[model samples]
Structure formats: C-alpha cells, structure tokens
Target: MSTTNKLLAGAAILVAAYAGSSWYVGKKAEAEINHQVNEINAAIATQLALSLGEGEIKLNVVDYDRGWFSSKVNYEIRIKSAKDEQFQFLAQDHLRHGPFPFAAIAKGHIAPLLAYSDAKLLPTKETQPLFDAAKGEEPLRAHSFISFGGATKTVIDLAAIDYRDEDGNQVLMAKSEGQVDYVRKGGKEQADFTMTFPSLSLVVDEGDLHVQLNGMRANGSITEQDKAQASEGELHIDQLGINVENSTQIFIENIKTASSYEVKDGLLDSTLTYDFGKILADKQDLGQMQLDVGVKRLDYVMLNQLSQVDDLDSMDEDELLPMIKQILVNKPEVYINNFMLSNPAGSSTLTSDVRFATTALDPVENEELDLGHYVESLNADIRLSRQMIKGYFSGENMISSMADMFFNSAAEEAQEAGLVEYDGNEAKLALSFDAATNKLLLNNKPISVEELVQILFSMQMGGGLF
Candidate 1:
C-alpha cells in the first residue's frame, strides 16, 4: 500500500474511536443525570420535614426529557404538621443541557409546583413518609404543570375530587391561568381531566360544583383546560386564581405578605400569600389561629402570617380560652358583589354580605360540656314582647334529659305541668347556657334573652322565693 492509502486508513480508525468514546460518555452522562435527580429527590424529602434543621425535608421530584441534548427536572416540596394538614412549596427544577463536559443549567420559565395533599398522618412510627409518597405522585404533578415558554398561558383545574364516574374519571376540570382556590365543583362544563391518560375522551359528568362568575369580574377572562393532580404533597403554580369559572378567587390583589404555617386543634393552616396571585382563601373549618393561640386575638393564617403573637406559651387555660373565643369572629365571608352560578340544575346570583360573628361562645362553658353532655337551664317566659311566651317557669336538666326538651322540651311539660299553651311554626330555638349545671335548654317556644337570664338568676336563688 502507498503512504497516502495507509494515512487515510489510520485517520478513519482514529475518527471511529473518537465517535465510540463520545457515545460512551453521553450514555454515562444520561445515567448520571438520572441518578443525580433521584439523589436530589431523596435529599429533598429529608430537607422538608416540619422540624427543619440540616436534613428534615420532603419533596416531589419528576424527571423530564427536554430532548436528547437537554432535560427538565421538576418537583415540589411538602412539609407536614401533626394534623392531617400540609404546607405546600415549590422547588427549583434542575434543567441540564448538552454533553457532559459542557452541560448547561436553566431555571423554569413559570414558577414550579409546590404543595401538599389534603391529607394527614395516622400517627405511625415512621420518621418520614413523604419521601415515599413524593416519589409515587411526582409524575402526576409534572404533567399538571409543564409549559415550555408560550405566549398565551394555559390553565387546567381539577375539582370534584371526591366524586367519580363510571369510566373511572373522578377529577372534574375547570381551566384558567394559575389556580383559583375555589373551583366550580358544581358547574355545567364539568369535564374529567387526565392528560396522562389519553384514552378517555372528554365526557359530560354528574358532580356537585359551585361555579360563580360576576359579569364584571369574569368578563374579560380566558380559560384553559384544567387537569392536574398532586398525589404527593407539592404546590403547582400553573393553575393560579380561579381561571376557570368560579373565582371569587380573591387573592392578595396588591398586598405584600410573607409566608408561614399554623397548626391548631389538630389542623394545619398555610399562611402565605405569594405575589398578586396567591390563593388566600379563608378556611371556615380552619379559621385564623396561631401557635400562641392562648395569648392574643391575632389571625395567624393570612394577614398575620409573620406576626409573632405575644406570650404564646406563657398563657394559661384562663388566658387561652378568650383567645380561642376570638377566632369565631373571623369565619369565612361569602360576599357576592355580583354572583352567578350557571349549570344544568339551576343558578342564582344576588348581592349579599355574610359576617362571621363570635357573639356568645363561653369556652369555659364549652370545655365543661364535652361528649354527649350539656348542662341546661330552661327559663320559660310569658308573652315575651307580643311574641306571646306563655309561662315564666325555669328548669335545669342534663343533656340526656335536655335532648328530651329538644323533642319534648315542653311537650310533656306543657301537657303534664300545663306550663304554656299553643303554637305551630312559631317555634323558636335558643340554648340557655347554665354556668352551674353546664346545661342547655332547647326553647322551641317563645322567649327573650333578658327574661331568660332573669329566670336563671331566680332559679339560682331558689325558684319561687327569688
């Protein structure tokens, strides 16, 4: 062979060897990236535990394939409290690009998903269960929030979480940009959302949904498809505000607030209102509370997430009762400036203002009246302000006996004792709190607050004599 031919053959071999080496490196890099993702997720689980320190965390991590050259890593962190409540959080998605030696990393375009499930623990002995749960549901959340930088954003929501269909579709969908805390679980366009499961065609379904829209609030709104589930506890920002239909989705429209969490009476409350799009719904069930609930009448959930209530621990049972009493005033207010809920069943809209009042809740009385027990003092009045209350007699009884009053408060007494007379829908209801007997009387008869109390004081001083 001539020198030129030999040189060509040698060059070809060298080129082939370089190509083989590159293939090996690329394959190993892919494996390493995947392995790293798993490791990152493992670390996240420990890093997100409620008692945050060096290694107590929870996470929902998903491995995404951007392309042969690039990959997207998405996931969320979920911290939990003792109650069956979750604190949601968003973690940065780790996006890796290019060949190993010159790989690149980028952050997500829209904020990543971060939230926990509407669940709680069973008091297991395990130190952490979210790590296991996070891995299981990370994929579902990934499909829930994935946008590759588009002009017009898309929103998909999943309501009717508790109801299911025959075709195995249980998640009801309402779409929009970001998520509104309250979706129309009872709307007309009720559709099941399962992007991961493509076989099920869109179908109409039956479920309880409350969809509200004010002509002024939802007129210029555009809706996207809402189909996402976070099995693992992670928060997804893809769906913010009620982009769908029912968005009294009032969030922190223009207020700057920090993030925090509160646990009370065995319930966990998330207290952060992020950006202008944060879903800060007032939970009627888990109303405003703080770790130091005994000391102050401050709301620890929304406006006061960062507020450190004074004398949290030093408060005694005496101090704490009043504070807890204060929570009753902040019950959820559903004000329909202009409301509309349209669907197959029916729809109604009207302007209304509902105020949550803590008028009279004697915590001292409540604590003593636990279980099926209640102390009652019945003060029957005669003609309470033309309300025509017949008799001005009072009696005290146990809840067991009190329940009799609910059914037969005056049935037998009215017949046997001939206390009062006559009535048909004029039935009234009031529980006269008994400080001594801890009893409550069900007045299906006419009565006044002042007359009722007077009867009670008279009974304490011995019925007829006082």
Candidate 2:
C-alpha cells in the first residue's frame, strides 16, 4: 500500500475506534445508572413497607434518555408498591439549558431531584408505603439555583424525570421550552381548588394533597395496612405556592412549613399552618379572616390530662369517675373561635372564653385528688359578634318530677304549704367564661374554688339560668 493511503487508513481506524469507545462509554454509564437506580428502588421498597404497610412491589422505569449533546436528560417511572396501588411521575429538563446567572449556571452542574409527588396523584397516600431517600446535595447559600443545583460547575439540565419504587413512592418532573405555567384543579362537585404557577413551581388544586417536599427523608416499612392504622388523610406540602384567577403571570412564593396533617371522618389533625395569608375569594372579595390557632385536640381525652392536675393525686378511685365526668361537662376546653352560629331563639356574633376545667367542676364531698393531665391555659377570641346553640333539649318529665319533689319536700318539712302555684319553668343556658387565677396574686381577692364549682352546677341546674 502507498504511505499516503496508510496514513489515511490509520486516521479512519482511529475515528472508528473513538466512535466505538464513545458508544461503549455511554452504554456503561447507562448500565451503572440503572444499577444504582435499582439499588435505590430496593431501599425505597423497604422503607415503603415499614412506612405505608406490606404489599406487592414493582418499580418500572418507562423511559430514560440522557442527551449530553443537548445538556439534558429525560426519564419516566411507574410504581406499584402494595395492593391496589399505582402512580407515575414525569421529570424533564432538570438542567437549565439556556443562559442563567453565574450562580444558577454553576449550580446546574449537580443533578437535582427530578421528580416529586402531586397531592391527588396517589389516592391511597395515607396507606402508601415509605421509600428510602436517595442521596442528595447538601444545603448551600440562598441563591435561585442553590437548593437544586450541583456542587461544581459545567451543568446539565433534566428534560423529563420520573421514578416509582416498590414502596409506592412516586415522583415526576418536567421542564418547559421557555417559561410554562402549571395549574391544578381538584375535588368533585365543589370545585375544591384552582392553583397555578410557572413550570418550576409546585401547585395543588385542593383535595387531600401535599406537595413541595422534594427533600424530605423517608424510611420505615411503607406497606398499606388496615385503614384503621393508616396515617390520616391529608395533603402533605413542604414547599409550594399558588395563583388564582387565570392570568399570564406566575408566582411561586410563600412556601409553607415542614408540616404534615391527617384527616379522618371529617376530623382534622392540626399539624400544619398553611392558612397564614388573607384569603381572597375572587377579584376583590374577602373570603376568610385572619386566624391564629394553637393546641387543638380531638376526642377530649380526659384521662391523658386529668391525671396531671394538682388536686387529682389525692382523690380516691371511686371519686375519680365523678370528677372526670363533671370536669368534662364543665371544664374541658374544646373550642372554635372566629365563628358565628345561630339558633331559633336569637343570633349573635361570638366574643367570649369557654371552658371545662377546675373552675367549673366541684366535689360534693372532700376526696383524694389525682390530676395528671390538665390543660393549664385556654382562651379564644371570636371574629364574629355572638355565638349560639342550635339544638333543643327535653325537660318535660324532669320538670314535673322536680315540681313534685319541691311540693313533697315542702309538705314533709312543714316549712311551706301545699303548692297552689309554682314559678318553676324550664330554661336552657349557654355560657361565656372569663377569669384567671393567681396564687401569686398577693393582693387580688381570689374566688374560692368551691364557690366556683357551686356556681357552675347551680348555673346548670338552675341558679343562673334566668
């Protein structure tokens, strides 16, 4: 062969070798990524079993394409971790391909979590099993890309991302060509919510949903079990924002707390403070008022707090029941403020304190006390003017019995004549409470504890009704 031909041949062979090596490197890198993903999937499954409950498991990656040329990667996932469980998320364009600020461009080098769950995407979320968290980037300075970028420079963005693990954990991600908006609408009949924002912002339309917890750590079995033991139904939102009245603009600010909540049988667990802003109904209308609430509990578990009070320790066993019952009736502090209710008799905006506590319950005789769980502070202010009771009570038979007892006692004692006419009439009473105690009120006169109890029972039995 000619020398010139030899040189040309060598160049051709080198080019082919380089192309083959590039292909081989890409294939190997993909295999390694899939292997790591599989490992991550397994860890997710174990946690799902522990957190959600036991169930069948499957993790499927529907599509995975990384375009180093485009500085982008795209993927999709479908997962079913337990019985009757399935969901999918799409993550795209995690890397910003266009020009950005220095910090944004530099942070883009590291991979961001490409997928996160939507509030309503998984209906059985309360029973959804847990998945172990994949390794993540550490916290950095407060910059636009700081939270979701890599530690080094030379960035690549994600085009689409999706993940589904055996533990029922699912995620989705996607990017837009320029800036795109996202809107979510949820609920049936009521049109529960309508929240929208740009492509990068997380949004929920309402219903039992939570979003923006892209960085929360998850562990423990995530298997779905009996509904009884499942976590409360709720939307778990870590960081999110919303926009009302469809428009061309988008805002993803006002991220809420590191909070979680549950709802069951129309009951709510007061775990998160999501409603912090003044809620506007539409163009120019106020819908909800400013409200700040603290320490709310359901089912008034008297036994939990009753055992902690100063006087309950000395109370005898038999005496405890009566005290507990009476305390619940008059002393328990279950309340709602800034609400208005109306009855057939009248209506009023409510403004008052209420209670079922030591000040309202009394013992007819001296007894040992053992109060271990008593609420020390309770107060609420209503935004409305008055509050009311809506239901009615029956007192016919009781009224007659009391009338007869009165006449009988008077005749037997001969302290009064046979009843000619009685002023007794049935009256129902609702109450508003106000007062504070101070053993340290060195100069203030204190109401006797016994007097307070006597007034409560007497008020309920009739003294203050009129």
Candidate 3:
C-alpha cells in the first residue's frame, strides 16, 4: 500500500476505537443514572406511605440526554392522596449534572448540579368547590434552583414561592435561599444549614387582611442520630419581622431565639433563650421581652415518641392522655433559669428549679384523672420578683385594684406565717409538696394549688373572683 493510504487507514481505525469506547461509557452512565433515580423514587414513596398512610408517589424520567462528560435529565413527580386520588401534588425538574464520575457511579454515589424545580398543589374534586369559593387557582407554583458540592455533599438551594388566584391576583409570595451541609462521622450523620428569606407576604380576605415580613434568617447544626438512638442540635435565629394590618394594627421586630438540645442514656437536656426586640400595637412602642429555659434528665423516649406523631389532629385525646401519664411517670427534671416580660413601663423575672417523680396514679372513674398522688413526689423552689408585682400595680385601674384585693385577703396571713419575705423590690417564696399531709406548701405554710390558681384567676377577672 502507498504510504499516504497506510497513514489514513491507521487514523480511521483509531477514530473508530475512540467512538466505540465513548458509546460504551455513555450507555453505562445512562443505566447508572436510571438506577439512582429509581432508588430515590422508592425512598420518596416510602416516606409518603408513612406520612399519608396509604398515599402513592410516582416519578417518571421523560427526557434524558447523555454526553461523554455531562448529562441532563427532565423528570416529573406526582403525588396523590390516599383518601382522594384526585387530590394531587406535582413537580417538574430539569437537572444538568457535571461529569458522570464513573468510579463514584460504580460505588452507587450520584451528585447533583445546578437544577431547576417547580411544584404545584392542586385541589381534588371533593375540595375544588371550596377552592373556587376562595378564589384559588390550580397552578400555584413554587420554583427553586438547587446546586450541590462538597467533599461530604452539600446543597445550596434558592427558591421562589408564589400562589395566585384565577384572575392572576397574587395571594402569597416568598423567596428563600439556603445552604445545607451533610457529613457522616463515626457511623452517624451530621448536618448544618443556614437560610434567609428576604421577603414574605400574604394577602387574604380580598386584600382586607395582609401580613408581610421584611426579613428572616436562621442557622442550625445537628447530629441526625447518636449511639443512644437520639439526636441533638443547636439553632439560632437572627431575626423575624412581621407586620399585620386589619381590624387592628400590629408589628413585631427582631424576634431572636437560640436553642440547643442533647440526648444520651435515656436522658434529654435542652435550653432555649429568646428575645423579642420590640413590638408595636396601633403604632405604640412596646419594649422587648426575654426568656431562658432549661430542662434536664427529660425522658428521651417520651419526647421522641411524641415527636413521631405524623398527624396530631387525627389523634384521639382518650388515647393521648394515657400516654402522657405514662410519660410523666418516667420522671423528668425541669429548671427555669429566667423568664422576664419587659417594656418601657416595667419589667419582672421569675426563676424556678423543680424535679418530678411519680409512684402511683390516682384512680379515675370516667372523670378527670386525679394527679394529686403524683404531686407527692414533686419538689420545687420558685421565686418571683416583687418588682414585677409592683410594676403591674404601678399602673392604674385594673392591676392596682387586683393587687389591693390580693393583699387585703392574704398579706397578713402570709406575714404572720413567715411565708412572705421582702427585700427592696424582690420577693422570695419557697414551694414544696408534702406526701403525708397531701398538701402543697408556700414557704412552709400549707397552701392548696387550687387556691393559688383561684387567686390568679380572680386577678384577671376584672379584679374579682368568679
């Protein structure tokens, strides 16, 4: 053969080999992606079954484009209610992914890239008339772009949600952007996230009732599950501002909260601290309030079980009360570090330390459960700042009159019994429960819990007992 013809022949063979290899890789990638998609669909179906009891979820990949180094998928997800098949929620997604990462795919790992998602919730035939009456539309939409990266897998999602009526009148609108991080360590999953919403607004009653939020932001981290079969986390909120105008005008600003929790060896510990920066009523400035609470040795099982109730609205009280009693019997300790309500007018603080134990439950004969037996095991010390009382009474009319009535009825008795101790603007009183006498004590003086409740009720009843 001629030298030129030999060179061309060699080149053609090389090109054919390359094309064959590319085709094989492309086929493998397609199969891998379809397998991963099926796994995800199965997971979604399982969760929906658990949540809706008998609901069904279906996922379909309608379009797919495969490339040597990248791929794209267009898929649809549909969910229908168990009770009413016509009630459905639907979503569509168009995802463009980076290189196939053949090695990861072989090991059953898949990564997602920047993707667009849009969803809608529709009414069923049984509920359509109500929706129509409310001037609602079937094509309400919430759309988002999701991008993921990180050695351990992280996701950054930006979303816009909107709901409108048939007339194209917006009813609700919101926008949020967030980053969520996930990592696995020591056989446990750990996650951290931060999210912010620049604006959220809702209009109802044909614009008669409107609520708007300027901004809201939050951050948190948590262990999904620990060795002791428990989860722990901490969360912080920078601010949540809301303004509402209707029959009454209301506004709130900078509502911040920080909280943490941990569970181990059948015990749960938690703390919550919050501050309401400011609130306005009819454009009147009402100063902020703060609170600090702590719980120790709380029954972890009880809390977890309570949290697992997927539908509380469907739960029967008769079936719930017994569980509550059983949980109380497990005994949990509680502490109140500080609870303060403050304003330009006045401020007060309350603090308490208490532990509960239960040996027996009082019998119930188709009536209310008598919790007196359980009270025998409680020991508590609660203190209230006399300043709070003074502040409440510092105002005229209602509070002052009520204070007068209370002091007239109990002040002398309390003093004679040494149950009342005063230091400047603070009052300290100790509370205990006595099993032998079946009595609840205030500063060593026997006082019925019922009586204390009565006193508080009377104060709020226009300064007189009912």
lDDT of 2 by residue, 16-43 (tens): 7755544444444445335534644644
Which numbered prediction scores highest in lDDT against the true structure? 3
Candidate 2: residue 358 Cα off by (Å): 23
Considering every candidate listed, which one attains the maximal TM-score? 3
- Number of clashing pairs, model 3? 0
Candidate 1: global Cα-lDDT?
0.31
Decide which is better by TM-score, 1 or 2: 2
Q: Per-candidate RMSD vs. true structure? A: 18.5, 18.2, 8.3
Give the TM-scores of the predictions, in the order they appear: 0.26, 0.29, 0.58
Error of 2 at 415 (Å): 37
lDDT of 1 by residue, 132-251 (tens): 333333212211221112111223322211224475434322322222121223221111221221111122232222322211111111111232111112122222222223433332
TM-score of 1: 0.26
Error of 3 at 152 (Å): 4.9
Q: Give me the runs in candidate 2 sitting further than 4 Å from their true place.
A: 1-10, 35-58, 62-271, 276-284, 287-466
Clashing pairs in 3: none
For model 2, what is the error of residue 149's alpha carbon versus the real structure, in angstroms, after optimal superposition?
12
Stretches of candidate 3 exceeding 4 Å from the true structure? 1-162, 166-174, 229-247, 259-273, 294-326, 360-428, 433-441, 444-466
Q: Which ten residues in a row have the lowest lDDT in candidate 3?
A: 143-152
lDDT of 3 by residue, 1-466 (tens): 9999999999999767655555555455456446545645644543342233445566777777765444455565555554545433333332323333433444344553222223343455544543454444433333332223211333343335465665434544344566655554466655566777677676664666667766677777656354442223333333343334455676777777777766667666777787778766665565677788887766656555554565557889887666666656756667777777766655656677655546444355555333355554445444444444444445456876677556444544444345555444444566666565666777677777666565555544534321
